[model samples]
Target: MCVKCDNCGAEIGLDGVCKFCGTVLPPREPVAPPPVAPGWGTPPPRPVFSIPQPRVPVQQPVQAASPKSRWVAILLWLLLGYLGAHQFYAGKVGMGILYLFTFGLCGIGWVIDGVSLFAGSFRDRYGLPIRV
Candidate 1:
């Protein structure tokens, strides 16, 4: 009977080696697949309704106003507004430096800041209003 090498598709010799590709061939036999359980082929049915999860209430943190006084900020602005002393007092170091270099945007920003301060609309670096 003729036996062929599975790897190289060449005729296998009596020593079970493929003469063309030098591959050893195993004895030819019919291979059967493993038997499956009767009900394992199909998946289990899913539930029609899903359970509702409880909602959690999240609370936000509250920030208190700055302890710095508005009157002191106003005073600093009046005295050295061009130098951004009020900005520094209000914990706005970046704006203070900008104001110092640009002379409070050539005094225009100084006037606007003074208006906002007197009108009770000015805020500190922490975004809290500086009132009273």
Candidate 2:
């Protein structure tokens, strides 16, 4: 026997509703996974990541000092003469800057400056010999 929907008068099936009746259906249950065998016990290994760093040379801070005495200038010449430390020490700023740029005129001017400082003939920026 065919059952009829009361609202639409259409033929219904075992689901108790006809196609044109717009009845709501029940929700389905979630599916379960199949059982695993006895011995699958090892954990997954972790991935290793290596990060690269940029290469840069280390630098040292410069300590600049300008001394007033010829003795100090001579000492600086003996120690850091090629770098124009003596000219800076003697208060010859322009010569010091030139010496700094030219590496004491490729060490020849450094030798002459050292000798002049020792001989008491090296003059300051004011044309005055550095005081002992």
Candidate 3:
């Protein structure tokens, strides 16, 4: 009789070790008897009925924005974003100046802007998407 691997359950030889699952059978345990009440035969297997269906197609926006790469923005942010260097690079001179004076809106504005920019919700001063 063939036996399944004790770990991965792949079919293995009746004796020795299993190469497919790489499990060494230390020792076999004593087989237990079934708990049926003597007269009943084994119950029928459960039925599988549902047919597989195709997955739904994902929808994407048709129009795309042309702006600078997300890395440049993130780089400027890392280097001088607190002083609005990233905003200046993105052509938002006013906000850049404001950020320079206000310390990136006292850190609150940049935190929100960082999340929005990374999440694809942020746009440039010219209303172009930041290609994240």
What does candidate 1's lDDT look like per residue over 66-85, in tens digits? Answer: 78899999999999999999
Candidate 3 Cα lDDT to native: 0.82
Please say which candidate is ahead in lDDT: 2 or 3. 3
Deviation of model 1 at 40, angstroms: 48
> TM-scores, in order shown?
0.52, 0.47, 0.51
- Looking at model 2, residue 112 earns an lDDT score of 97
The total number of steric clashes, by the backbone 3 Å criterion, in model 3 comes to: 0
User: Which candidate order results from sorting by TM-score in descending order?
Assistant: 1, 3, 2
lDDT of 1: 0.91
Displacement of the residue 63 alpha carbon in candidate 2, Å: 33
Which segments of candidate 3 are over 4 A away from where they belong?
A: 1-61
- TM-score between model 3 and native: 0.51
lDDT per model vs. reference: 0.91, 0.77, 0.82
For 3-96, candidate 3 gives per-residue lDDT tens digits of: 7887888877766578787787877787898678865987767998998899999899776774577888888887888899888888899999
Best by TM-score: 1
Which 10-residue window of candidate 2 scores lowest in summed lDDT?
22-31
